[model samples]
Target: MSNSARSLPDVAYVAQPGLSGRLDWVGMDDIQAPVMLVGEDDQPMRFPARVGAFVDLARPDQRGIHMSRLYLHVDQALSTQAVKPALLRTLLDGFLASHRDLSSRALLRIRFDYLVRRRALVSDNAGWKSYPVVLTAKLEGGRFDLELGLEVLYSSTCPASAALARQLIQQRFRADFSTQDLLAREQVAEWLGSEQGICATPHSQRSSAEVKVRLREDVESLPFVDLIDCIESALQTPVQTAVKREDEQAFAGLNGGNLMFCEDAARRMQSALDRDARITDFWLRASHFESLHPHNAVAVASKGVPGGYLGGSTV
Candidate 1:
């Protein structure tokens, strides 16, 4: 095995002696790879996107780290508008093919800011903002795991608690059946200010919608946007990304009528996800940054993972 006859790296980058330490994988995170990822833009978002990649490198006995090859695989897949679970699965398959002797387990993480324009409630003014997002993809034993997460900003209107207070306040008063057997919400609002009502509507700002689903075998598509729409609609007081006065008026009316507590928000979201047929399994978390309290309020529900979905147990 003379020098010319020996194997050499097919890539240009060189790994320094013992530079990778004992870690099985290491590489750039902010390394931007242009992608037209599915479920993102209705049109292709072909700008540079950042991804965190890891390739298995065994003992120091190995000759080279296939870093460039790994990047190339990512680039190639991303070149087409074909980035999703299947694409990632193929990339991992390619990675394993390139490093046959190394371990088969591979991990890929994509972290990027997703921006959408929202309409302001009353002004209908357009505002552009970004949401922090992360996608975790892993391949092992010929199967792949994909997770997509979105943190959404919203406001929760405390309806249940308000109703409770209205009930408590009106229980002892000179209430009559002529009262229409129904107390107008406006009446409840006035009674609280006039009497010993412990009622208050607290708005929780900056809520998050976090969902992860298993893509089923026969399913043709993943309704990521539709799910996002359902989740946002369930929030009732979803903050606007683009708004006109009409949108604002609609939103304000929504706040007035669809008051919800943190618990209510969680249940509403759970119901929305449950109605979605595309998702095989789901996990939901709602983090509400409270305006009235020092600490945030949070509620969580998952299908089959919690006791059951919608804050229930035993399915």
Candidate 2:
């Protein structure tokens, strides 16, 4: 009826029962949406993701931000065409456009599971493994920081346990058979091959490679696959996808050869990260879910510049 032309105010308005002195930043957090996008595997994937966003409401006396508009902007973008990095940027950019007078910055986050088809070690038969990927972006002063994070599952074995098993088997064989009557080495080796207890370690389960990268501001390329591969290769002990008997044997051999404790796995990943020139900084955590113990064993490492270690002083 009036000149405004808009039917009604869309923002979530809460009538303050009692007024406060001031409120700085008040917005929405954990709003969920199913967004369509090309996954890291380069195929169309839809994500039912939760978003956490915040916006600043200006004026020294203002109470809160427009929470409804923020949620609506994210929902609209999520419901649009297949999401790419560029499209996500559009969503963050649009938040500012929708509320021009409210704030200078808008933060957006989307968490989704990325399904990757992996082949079996013995079967070449394909199956899906889900990796959690998070897409995050921030817009302020016409600059955007885009970050993509992914987690890769791998495996490892314990070297100390393997060594102990070998020694124990040899000792048992020697004790059971006389020194003059039987040679322990050949008998122990055969027993080790046959015995289930000595064949593998106590704690051999899946390990994960977690990687996050800040996309180059000028370039549009997000090397998601390459980043994942680099992480897997760094670990050097990924569980096999497709396998024949030979593949299974090879996988077993890899697990045996790369016998590692949690600390060893962490060090290996760290060394690999330090060797790779593509990453700016990296942090790695290697965990071994214990079969014998109730608690898990873990090790962590981070990549830091060697300014002071190379004779320069620390900040």
Candidate 3:
């Protein structure tokens, strides 16, 4: 037999469909890939990201989408280029171009753990802290949108609990010391330095703030570190990774000074987000895993931007 004849195969025996409907989104998820992202220092940082790529199938007669084309385009775009809003726009353009008749919109979401180096409070030591970060981009009807999501962990001391604990400490102090002993400054100082002085301690729990913000058109790069800094500064009690005796003491002092309820945390995050001009809209959820209770305390806040986020979805 001839080589051409042997290589030939049946071309008409492919899967066929009778009818097809328009799909809002058609693509892949949990795609493990290495992507290069621009960091806060304006340097390229590479990370393994879980990516989701989708495009709207507008054509109703199409049997199915070319899934391999979407995957290949994503691989090409993310592997060589640094992640930014502009690059994402180009990627979305490519998605629509590759599927000219079938797709009209494209969306991409990349989730990764970003490592940030944090300095110990009141100590020279530092450690690496990982923040769960997500970047999402969407292109629809010739308009592009970008959003950034991150979670910040901190310590939240209950204000009401703190007051109750303070009252108990005062009662204990009065019971331990007579009226004449209270007048002696040296004796009182010694008593205050002892562990017995603080007989009761306020309840504090590790809390997290999950925030998502839509970026303005003028923003050229992702501001992950800046957002994290703003949240930590507002909360005043970010959890520490590296700790010494002095560092722990300083962290405790910070928590004592910044006692807050879930409502306070949500408002603080909202106020901090409002001052940033680069953020057009935001949704924040502050969750306190209460130590004294079996359930978590959560407060949600969002900027009521018309036609923007409605505080319904975390994505």
lDDT of 2 by residue, 125-199 (tens): 767767787776778888877777778777777777778777776666556555567555875567656764254
> Each model's TM-score, in the order given?
0.70, 0.77, 0.92
Arranged by TM-score with the best first, the candidates are 3, 2, 1
Off by over 4 Å in 3: 1-19, 40-42, 179-182, 311-315
RMSD of 1: 6.7
Whole-structure CA lDDT of model 3: 0.88
TM-score, prediction 3: 0.92
What's the ranking of the predictions by lDDT, best on top? Answer: 3, 2, 1
Cα lDDT computed for each candidate against the true fold: 0.65, 0.67, 0.88
Worst 10 residues of 3 by lDDT: 8-17
Q: Per-residue alpha-carbon lDDT of model 3 for 1-315, expressed as tens digits?
A: 599966876332234447667889989998888889776676788989999989987877666666777888889988999887888888888888988888889999999999888999988999999999999999998888999999999999999999999998899888887555436788778888888988889999999999999999768888888999999999999999899999999999999999999999999999999999999999999999999989999999988698887753542
**Candidate 1 weakest ten by summed lDDT:** 306-315
lDDT of 1 at 74: 76
Off by over 4 Å in 2: 1-25, 39-43, 58-60, 180-192, 196-202, 240-248, 274-278, 305-315
Which candidate gets the maximum TM-score versus the true structure? 3
Worst 10 residues of 2 by lDDT: 306-315
Task: Go through the candidates in order and give the clash count of each.
Answer: 17, 10, 0
